[model samples]
Target: MPASGPPDQGEGKRRPLTALEDGYHIVTTLGSAATVLCATAFPIWLSRVRDNARALSGQSPRYARPWLYAGWIVPVANLWVPRGIVADIHRASAPGERLPHAVNWWWGLWLAGMPSGTGLMYAVPTDHVIERAYRQVYPLLAADAAVVAAVVAGVFVVRALTAAQRRRGVDSVRARPTAEATGRA
Candidate 1:
């Protein structure tokens, strides 16, 4: 039999979204934005702190601050580059202090989730088919789970290291000593 409306190709015709789906879309969009901000800010903030800590301690980090930001944005290098930069920052943030477990957890979860979030997983059908629909959905779910874990672990690492640095009396990594601090007009 012929289909009713415009051809949907293999998929069925689309229907108007219910209020729940609409609300879900809105929330996910906002949540995604927040996720992006946190993801970017985590590396940059840590990198800056690490840089300052290194400068104050008379030692240099293997990963520069700019690489911390740009590495994640670049292609072919993002796989391990950002994680390496963050690991370096994690190490340098607190001189002579052991890297926290949260750092390792974050790296592990990030590596686990990276493939799921990238071109490896495509959005597949959400139907209840055993092989047809689930192969795609499961990966996305796993990816989301891993990413959430990574973000939480990152929060832990950032808070712990930031507090550690402040307790050790490291200067702010804002690229300038303020007039009040410098005591200069």
Candidate 2:
């Protein structure tokens, strides 16, 4: 039989959340909502860009349109498909150019962050994570660093891809009049 006094004094009883814990909960909730929003919107944006890339490069897509979203969720395939998708976009946008380094860096760091404390924070309860943090902090810190690096690399990838597509579009427009003038259009 367990004897209870104050909640924190009891072996099995739960205590009221501290202000920091409460704030953590709120922040995590908001982060989760934002993640959902981004998850939904990202695939749509990727699909549009992929179509444009295909048209610009005159090459068929490496993966079908649906893979933009599924590639992230599917097991095993997830490891490579998402990277492939981004690579395809860059390749198509700049056919003769080498692939951007940011794409590889982003994917590598993203993968490293997963299966770390950062990923565990998303998978486990907040209380459990806070408790674990007291005992082991380095893993969490490393994970966070990886995730942050991934985000920075991801931004570079987006900029590179967007710029490549813009260049391709401008080149296509410039070539159009020439083709017509040469009776090739």
Candidate 3:
């Protein structure tokens, strides 16, 4: 029978979360702004990255496969690509057995920011507007930003606490030992 008093009692003490988690969340939240920012920034970033890649490889810009081109330019597909890439990046950076909090933060802000920013920039504008209508839009957009900021901040707090718990050697607060397991451990 496995012996235990507290969970993770004999497992080597876990290290505190590295700064990477905090930095990753911050960068991701900003990057999620790319959905709107990307409407303006992605094409530029993509162009630069592509140009750099081509220059390094000495390859001419060849026609990309139709699906590849479509995946990037199409609305629904574009969202998925960036999201998947961010998740993959988070997965790569996280320690084994640790949940990828970075992925959660990235996805939450990315999904929320995209629709919120896009709605503010594209949907709210009208063919005809009253004089003060434009002025009102900015405040609405500011409110959206504030809400997103709160959500992102909340994500960071949860992630930080989880990391601290891990460092203190509580493997998982949600885990419950079975009757036999509890007696043995």
User: In terms of TM-score, which candidate is strongest?
Assistant: 2
- Tens-place lDDT per residue, model 1, 78-169, is 77776676566655656677778887898789879876553212353322211222246577678778988988998897787776666555
Name the better of 2 and 3 by TM-score: 2
Per-candidate TM equals 0.69, 0.79, 0.32
User: Whole-model lDDT, candidate 3?
Assistant: 0.42
Q: Kindly give the number of clashing pairs for every candidate.
A: 0, 0, 1
Q: Higher lDDT: candidate 1 or 2?
A: 2
**Stretches of candidate 2 above 4 Å error?**
1-12, 118-122, 170-185
Error of 1 at 144 (Å): 1.2
lDDT per residue as tens, model 3, 1-185: 11222122335642333344345446545745654663555344334333333333344434333423454557877767644433332232232434455545654655565543433335332211111223465744654675567456545634543443334333332222334445564
CA lDDT of 183 in candidate 1?
A: 67
TM-score of model 2 relative to the true fold? 0.79
Candidate 1 lDDT (Cα, whole model)?
A: 0.63
Tens-digit lDDT track for model 2 on 1-185? 11322223346668776666678678767757766776677677677678778777788989987788889988899989999999998888788999999999999998888668444226676766665565677887787788778878988987888778766543233123234345565
Candidate 1: residue 93 Cα off by (Å): 3.5
Query: Where does the lowest 10-residue lDDT sum fall in candidate 3?
Result: 125-134
